[model samples]
Target: MDLDVFVAAHQAEWARLEQLLGRGRRLTGAEADELVALYQRTATHLSLVQSSTPDPMLTGRLTQLVARARATVTGTRRSGWRDAARFFTSGFPAAVYLTRRWWIPTALISTAVGVLVGWWIATHPEIQNAIGAPEDLKAMTKPGGGYETYYSSHPAASFAAQVWTNNAQAAAICLVLGGFLGLPVLYILWQNMLNLGVGIGLMSSADRLDVFLGLILPHGLLELTAVFVAAGTGLRLGWTVIDPGHRTRRVALAEQGRAALGMAIGLAAVLFLSGLIEGFVTPSGLPTWARITIGVAAEAAFLLYVYVLGGRAARAGDVGDVERADQTATLPTAA
Candidate 1:
């Protein structure tokens, strides 16, 4: 059959099927059977039409039909409860995928580099001197000396502003670099890890490791973990473009981009909160045990939400499932 004729036939059938579906009434067995047969035929025709010469008008019409069909299947409006539940559920799968698939590996690799380089630099007094002379080393080695002194001198507003600006810049770098094939993203990750290692090494040298831990661990755990998550998202996004894995590049990019964006947004929010904590709470002379306890508890809460709460939420209203239908029915519809 001619391509135009084939598309026309399918388009007519697709429109009719859409109308039937849109009626929003239960279909009789015969009507449902007929609709299913028509759907299958239309799908076959669409495949053929796609492979043949493309018509802009037909393609547009088909796109519209498909979008309408999707809306009908997914529902036109979502409740706030459903939205919150979905956000929670979607987060864990992304976190799990990131941790096992990318974050943990990247962190391990980066940490290894940081430890090796940091250890060498710490042990070699000459290199340390080059980075900062022996006289000035006190400032470098001490936690509440250089940057901390600057921070302490600044007004509360200025300090808060600096923290927010710095953290936002870091998050933006992680997100934007993901589009550049992940090399830039990896570089950002490495730089962060390197800085952290050097900071710890310097503190160890000054015999103020406990002070550093009390100051940074309070918020560093959340802040650093969020960065790792952001970097993982970027890595996955870059990999999707480079290696599409059985799907077309465009399709894979779309799918991976959605997942990556979700993770990136979640991480950004986390980093923002971490920055607030670091700026306001960390600088205070909180006890080491208190800092450790807060850090551990914060991590525990995050883990529970991601692994348990999030998982349950995602499965809560899965499309086409009985649970979803029951939940939807319980929601009050507009009169």
Candidate 2:
């Protein structure tokens, strides 16, 4: 058949098939199968038309038709805030479970284990002498320095500034390192673990473990958890590119990016707040119980927001008929 005739015929059939498909709630299995068959027939006709034609206009028309079909099959509209809220909340429990079940425990255990091992190794008289321990370690059997000196030197303002800077740096690292194709992010996590371990070890060795915990535990829990969550987000992004499963890599990455970015934003907020607590509140001689209570409350609030409040907001948004109608209207239609 001539290319023009073939194109005109396929366009009519396509329109008819679309109308049939749109007539009811959804296409039944048999209807869906028939639709698939029609699509195959369309493809075959287009292939034959292209092979038979030398005219540029015919080729261009064929190209345009294929492009439209591809878009119809793959294109998705940008989800509005309501859709975003729903997705964010719906996934909250899973996020919390993942963090508490694995991320938090892993970071805590790893740091504790490293600290224990390091303290044991460092404090051994034989090793200490062999390594020619620093004079200060021998000179001060008691942990030196008071809260006044530490707070005065590092002040709340300075501390908050430092925390904010570090949190920003960590967030950037999570986004960049996690997007890589290899184990770069894992390596980054390992380095973080090592630093945490060493700090714990040093504090323990100085017999200032309680003091250190008082200062860190108040905010470290939130700040470090945020880091892990960010890393997890990155890992998901990398996984989409590396192991896209059934979907094309590009599609997988786009979908995962949307979900992961939401989590990352939440994590960044956590880090910022944690920094504030660490710099200002943690340094004050607040009662240990009060600090612990506040820390627990913060964590609880985070959990509730991510798991409960977030989900409720999303569901409400999803059920907004007016909003969905607006969205549908704005979406591009098949030509």
RMSD of each: 7.6, 9.9
**lDDT string, candidate 1, 1-335, tens digits:** 58656655555788777777777678788877766766556555554555565567765665456545545545576457875565546653434444445776776787788677767766777767777777687965565586456435666556766776777677667766686798888788778877877766676677776766677777777777677767776787788778977766765666566556556556666666676667666665667688667777776666676656555545553211123332211212233
- Residue-wise C-alpha lDDT for candidate 2, range 87-187, written one tens digit per residue: 44555434434434435654566566656656764466564454335574434324445432453368788778787787767765765666685267666
lDDT (0 to 1) per candidate: 0.64, 0.60
Indicate the TM-score of model 1.
Answer: 0.72
TM-scores, each model vs. reference: 0.72, 0.60
Model 2 residue 79 lDDT score? 68
lDDT score for residue 281 of model 2: 75
Weakest 10 consecutive residues of candidate 2 by summed lDDT: 324-333
* Clashes by residue pair, model 2: 86-314, 89-310, 89-311
What is the Å distance of residue 266 in model 2 from its true position?
1.8
Which runs of model 1 end up more than 4 angstroms from their true locations?
1-48, 51-61, 68-75, 78-81, 89-99, 133-135, 142-144, 150-165, 310-335
- Model 2, TM vs. native: 0.60
